[model samples]
Structures are given as C-alpha cells and as structure tokens.
Target: MSDDGRQPDDPLSRFLHGETGALVFVREVLTSVLAVALVGLLLFAVSGVWPPMVAVESGSMEPHMERGDLVFITEPDRFTPEFAHGDTGIVTYETGAAEAYTTFGEPGSVIVYHPPGSGGSPIIHRARFHVQEGENWVDRANPDYLPATSCEGVPACPAPYDGFITKGDANAEYDQVSGIAPVVKSEWVHGVARVRVPYLGYVRLVFSEAVLVQIDGGADGVVPAVGGERVSVTGSERTTTTGVVGSASPTLATGSAHGTPTATA
Candidate 1:
C-alpha cells in the first residue's frame, strides 16, 4: 500500500498524482501530441481544407478584426453565397479611387487569400466587390473619389482578371495599391474567415516575422498598427507607413514615394 492509502499497482492513481518516471512523462507527452493531431485531422476532414485556421498579422481588417486575432477560415465553397462579381458581398473600390465609405453588416465577412503572383503571405481583408474581366470599378460611396492618375491608360480597375476587389474597412485604398497584387477567381482566392478567437494569435504573430514578410511582403509586411494593419500611400513610389494612429500622421489620401511605382487601380 502507498502512503495515500492507495495500492502500488494503481496505474490510474499514479497518473493522477503525476508520480511517474521518464517513460511515463514521455508517454503523456506523446498522448497529448497525438490527441491534438487527431483533433486537427478531424477538423480538416470536416472542413474539407488543410489550413482551416489563420492568424491575423495586420491591422488592415482593424476595428472589425484586430491584429493577433486567431481567425477560423473555411473553404469558400463550403459556405453559402460563394464570392461573385457585382451587387453582392462587400463593395470594394479602386486603389486610389476610394477615400471614405461604410460597408454593411459588421464590416462584411473577412477573407484570407493569396494574392495572385505576389508570393506573399495570406491576406486577411474583406471582399468589397468583384470585378469581371475588362470591367471598371468606381466609388459611389466616395465623394472626392479619384481614380489613380496612373490608371488612366489601364484597361481594368483592379487587374486584367475576374475576381473580388478587397480592402481594409479603415483603409483609404484598395489592396492593389496597398501592396497586394490582385485577387483572382481561378487563381488566388483562398478561404473566408467564419469564426474568430481573439488575441491568442499574438503568440504566433510575436514570433512570426519571416512568416509575416512572406504573408504580406518584406516591405508590406503587416506590423500591428494603431489597432489596424500597416498603412501605405502609393504614387510614383509607395510610401510605407507604420505605427498607430495619432502616434504618426496619416498618409496623404492620394499618393507618396516608397514602393515601386505602378499603374494605379
């Protein structure tokens, strides 16, 4: 009998008291690992996607979804109202075309996507509207909205494809000028965020810089900014802006000189 009035062969009691050897400790660790892996595999099977969870690294989706918020994403087709062009979903604007506006119903659903050809990290933002190939997007919500001067000769509003034009709710520009290439239907759109587990994602974001750079870009990498994502103004060159609001002055609503100059919108 043991001091606690338990039998020596009480395996369950030994585990309860954590009175075990290295072998037992190793067994416990392995059990935990396996248990977690099993749960993950189950979620993957149920969701029909490999990566069903994503960490928010930028403030782009701010006020609505903050930095470090752990977001649960599901395959787009798994849910209703698959992303489509025009008259549905959130309304997006051209890179330099939109200055101010409000989206419906809790700033719209946040989407995590791989912008085609950018080779950056997954982006978390909202789909304002989708542009059909060879279509032009204008801002009725923006009073002083002006298309980027560089977009003058461009054949399309976002890009030369049919896909959703996404943006941060608090941002003045679209993803294109903000540094993300363009989201395409057949190529780049990944998944949409359905659920959010707040603040826990910071554990990863705190350690994920190289990962962050890959997610956004080395320059456009999302660093937590004023309860929002990184801010930039694109003109002849792109101006990368960091820091929280009120700490740093807002970038010009029009343009600046920081990243490579490209045709706008």
Candidate 2:
C-alpha cells in the first residue's frame, strides 16, 4: 500500500473524496472521458448509416411494438424485409421505388425518420408504399381505402412526393392525415426496426425519470427514495421524448453506409 494505505488503482473513490493527487485525478478523469468518447465515435463510424438504436415512446405500433421498448435499428441500405416470397437477409430498398414495396411479415417496412418541415424528433412507423406523381397505392392491408387523387385530401408534401407513404400500425389514418405529413424521401429515412427488448427501457425511464406516477394534481415523473428525497421530473415532455417499450426481435440493426446522424426518438 502507498503512504495513504490505498490501492493505486482506486482512482474513483479517491477522486470522489478529494483525496487523490491533482495531476493523478485529472489524468484519470480525462482518460475515462476519452475512452468513452472513442467508443462512441467508433460506433458512429460503423453504424452511422442509420442509428443503431431508438427508444419507443408511444403505443402507435401496438401488439407488435409497444411503449418503453428499446428498438435496435439497422441501416436502410442493409435492412431486409421478410416478404411473402422469402427472406433475402440483405439490403433491398435503397431509394424509393416505383413499385415492389417490401414488407416485414406485414404490409410495410417499420421506418424511423424525421419530417422535412416539422422540425420534430425522429418518428418510428411503417412505410406502406412508395409513390411517384401519378402512381396509385392500393392498400392490400386496407381494401376499402380510396386515394385522395390530390394533395387536398392527403398530407401536404413539402414538394411533390417521390417517396414512400408512412403509417402507424395502430393509428386510424396514415401519417399524412395524422399531421406528420406524407411522402418520406430516401434522404429523410434513417433506421428500420430490427430487434427489440421488452420493457428493459423501464430501467432507463426510471433513472432518467421518463417513467412517472401522477403526483398531487399534475402528472410528474418522480421516484421516492428512502429518506423521501425524490428524483423529480418537471416541465417537459421528455417523459415521452425518448420512449422505451416492448416488442419482438432477434438481432440489432445493420447499416448501409456510415456517417449519417440519426436524431433521438
């Protein structure tokens, strides 16, 4: 033992108690920070084609995906859908196509993206079909649906759409009608949901105060501790900002390219 009778490697305890040498403590802290930053940069370098993960917020996906799930996302270029024919296990859709939209044991690809003009956070939903100027998207999933024939009845696009239309699995209307607008382009698209862990996100929610119980009159996010000190959450929708829930899945996501920055859920 040293003159202080402490192990040389116990930097954390020393730093916390203001007992370590100034240079030693600074070195230890910088070393830790740099190591973490390096790992993050490495993940970004490889998986930046699409964000590797997203936290589920709302119940829009229901039955299949639920709130408080951590969804592992894959790069659009590397994501493959299990179609009616068979599974390719490779990247299929790159840019939007005129026809032959793919599915994941359903009607559309579950996509994560940001709206062009809304300036909102990234949304995770299913991409039903890719449409050009005059193409008709007949929903096999919904047989009685009718096309708007004009932007008048559809979600107004920033420009004319040459991309895919998205929808929430549990929602009554498509994203366009749901106020998220219609026509997501190849550029706006980010990750596709691949695998999800059930309710594991509650741990994050608990610590981050994303999970809450109603307090007094207003619903506040707080966890009461032994001495009655609570981790309180206030004045924000952050409880739902980056949501986590349950869903079905096997592996994490695959990336098509690298360096793209995906937004928070």
Candidate 3:
C-alpha cells in the first residue's frame, strides 16, 4: 500500500496515471476524424467537385440578394444566348472565369446576349459588356470561317451564334461600346449562382474590401463598424429568396449566414 492507503499497482491508480495524456490523444483523434468526415460530407453534398465562391461585395442584388450575402456556384456545360426573363441565375462576363470577378482587376466590357423572347440578365450591375449580337462582327484568324464574336463549339458564327452577355447588377448604365468578347463556350461559365445566404456575405465583403483593417485600433473600434462574422444588418429583410426552377433548402432560408448549416440537394 502507498502512503495514502492506496496500492501502487491498483487498477484505479493505473487508469488515472496518464489520464491527461490519454485525453489529449483521444481528443486529437476525434478532431481528425470529425474533420475528415466533414470534408467528405461536404464533397458528397455539393456533387463531386468543390466550388470556389465568396460573399457579395455590394447590394446590386438588393431586395433579393443583399450585400454580404454568401453565394455558391456551379459551372454550366454549354453557353446559350437565351435565358428566361425575370430569371435570377448566375451570369458571367466575357472577361475570365468566375474567380476573376472577386479578385482585383479592371472590369472588361461584354455584350448582353438576349435570346429571342427572353428577358435580360439579372440585377448585378458591376458586369462589363463584351459584344452585342448584331452590332459587332468578327472573322476567325484561321480558315475555320468562325466569327471572332461567336462562342466556341457552336455552328459557324453569325449563322447560329451562341454567345453570352455579361453585366454587373449594381451599375447604373449598360455597357455598349467596349467591344469585349462574348462567352460563347460553356466552359467559360464557371458556375451558376445557386444560392444566397444573407448576412454571411457581409463577412466576406468586410475582409476582402479591407473594411476591418481601416477601423482596427481606432476610436470607432467599439462602435461596431462591422468586422468578423457577427455583425448583423439593421432592419434587414429576413425572408429567404427561393430559386426559380425549384424550392431552396429550408435550412439556408431560415438559418443565419454565420451558421454552419448544410445545403441539401
């Protein structure tokens, strides 16, 4: 027996000998397993590949999608000139891939490709205009007889033109003169703006727009100028906007932007 009347070889003592170390080991393992499961679940839920996206920088999509809203995307397979009017899907400019929009770069011009009887693109006004359907024309550099303004993989240009229009929702005026190219190929479309999580986008806007760094350590620090994922919009509309094709996920509609709610297909 030990000094305290407990045997050194007691089963209870042995169990308690390295309890802290054991706890740490168990904690680390559990954490790793959880992380793996989470990643796998996300991958499975969002289809095979993970998408790249960020929060809305402005309120161009206001009354529908607000500033600081979180947007998820999925690329389209083919670029068609027509979209149903009054429809709010993710559209891109002729400039570059989807990632380019959020990055620092000069805005390029692109045409607003309107299919016959279809309404124009949605409200994001920051988009640049590339080419107009009949206003601009292009001839391929090779004997392929393709038009410069026509999208790829479609029939010869000007005959069966399959180009796309692009624009920014917040802009006051439409682009008409830049002569930017159209997104004729489906590969050019990085993804569709599938869903918008309100208020969640604000965090991304603050970080990407440098709103926090400007106010850090300042007298206004306590004023709650907006930082991190906690700031909420005053009098903001709380209702969710459902997609046109089908109903949006209930969790996305009701949950807060900062909440780690999963989206169901």
Candidate 4:
C-alpha cells in the first residue's frame, strides 16, 4: 500500500480503483488501443503480412467462404506447398486437385490479389490455373467456365502475358470472361488466405459502410477507371482502358465484390 492506501506497484489495481473517473476513462481507451495494436503485431509476426486479415463483402465466394467472414492471410512465399505454382508459392485448383492439396474447403489456395487493370479493391478468389504468355489457354480451361468456344472469343486467351486465371466459387462465369478481372499476376497478389473466422468481418464492413456513406453521400456509383476515365459497366461487358489491361471497372462486379483497401475477402 502506498501513502494513499492504494497498491503502489500494481498498475491494474490502480487503474481499477485509484484513478479519477476521467483519468480512468482515458486509461481504458489507451489500454484498449494498445491491446488491439499488440494483437495486430502478433498476427503480422505470425503471418508475415501487414494488415493480415481481410473482410469478405460479397457472396461471390459463397458456400466455401461467405460474406462477413474474417480471413487471415499470409505472404505467398511462406509455407510453400510442394506443388505451388513455381516459386510464387501458389497452388492452382488444377494443381491442387491433382496433388490432393486443399485450402478454405477447396482444392487450391484462396488469394487476395489486385485485379490486373481494375482499381476498386483486391479480389479474394481461387486460382483456377496458370497460363503462359501466348499459350492459347482456352482449350485448357474448364469447359463449364468458358463462355466462348474459341480463344478468339475470350478476352484473355492466348494468355496476355503469364498469369493465373481466377474465379469466384459461386459466380457463374470466370472473372476474366465476365470482366471482373484479367489474368492475375503474382506480383499483384497481396496475400494468400490461410484461415477464416466467421462473422467477425461484419464489424469492419459496418465501419466501411459508414465511411462510404460519408464520402460518397451514400450513392453507389460506378468506380472510376484507371487513367481517370469513367467506366459504365453492364452485365459481362469487358472494359479496357488505353494502355491498361482489360477488365470490368475496378468495382469487381463478379468476384468477392468490394474488398476494402489493405483489402476485403
């Protein structure tokens, strides 16, 4: 006990009983902030990725990964699977199916990647396969996922430079075919989703909605395109900006819709 009859060496006890109301409130706020910071640091240390978690915002990846799920992600290079796509450390659904590898209830890794030419948010989807530059990948793609019979009819066929073909689990068309995104380059990937915690992501989503309401006055308008062009997206129309890879406007109309920056699921 100190001269004031409080436990002199116990900070928690001091916080609980010895502090004034205003001081205690301040301490509570600071302590909560510090606790959150520590948890974030720990997650970063374990995952080797900054802002290691993402919130799911759409049903594009439904049944396997649903909206409002908090997904923990890691650097692609960490925990490399035996059959990862080269040194990029990503296993496509094709490779994973063959090797019996699986993640997030599917036969491949779920990744958070920046859509090649879009600008809204990073997409969370499965890597279906890898295509080499000029490789006419149309034949290799799943027939069910193909909208066209020939490579010429597909936007990203003959492989527009080597990259992965991505798709949402529940969406009817491939992201490339539907203009959600072009082929995803490994460099555009932010992280590989490793674990999912249900319902926690809604907290982030609620805050995001509040911010958007403030910024855009609650109007859900088309997201601006790269290079300052305004894009109007209709169902399945491919959008291509000058000197930019082709896709839907960065709103990502197909896959995992609207990942927030640092990104969503």
Best by the TM-score measure: 4
Model 3 poorest ten-residue lDDT run: 256-265
The candidate, 1 or 2, that scores higher on TM-score is 1
Q: How many steric clashes does model 4 contain?
A: 0
Report the lDDT tens digits of candidate 3 across residue range 1-265.
5899755876556554434667567667766767755753563356221222323333323344445555443333223223311122333443334335431122222111112221111112223323334433334212232323343433323323434433333222221112112333323332344445666544433322213322233222211112111111111122123111111111121111111111100
Model 4 regions more than 4 Å off: 1-17, 210-265
Question: lDDT by residue for model 2 over 94-153, one digit each (tens)?
Answer: 222333564434444576666555442356666665566554444322432223544444
TM-score of each: 0.62, 0.54, 0.38, 0.76
| Highest lDDT scorer | 4
Give per-model CA RMSD: 11.3, 10.8, 16.0, 9.4
Q: Which of the two, 3 or 4, has more TM-score? A: 4
* Candidate ranking (TM-score, best to worst): 4, 1, 2, 3
- Compare candidates 3 and 4 on lDDT and give the better one: 4
**Model 4 clashing residue pairs (backbone):** none
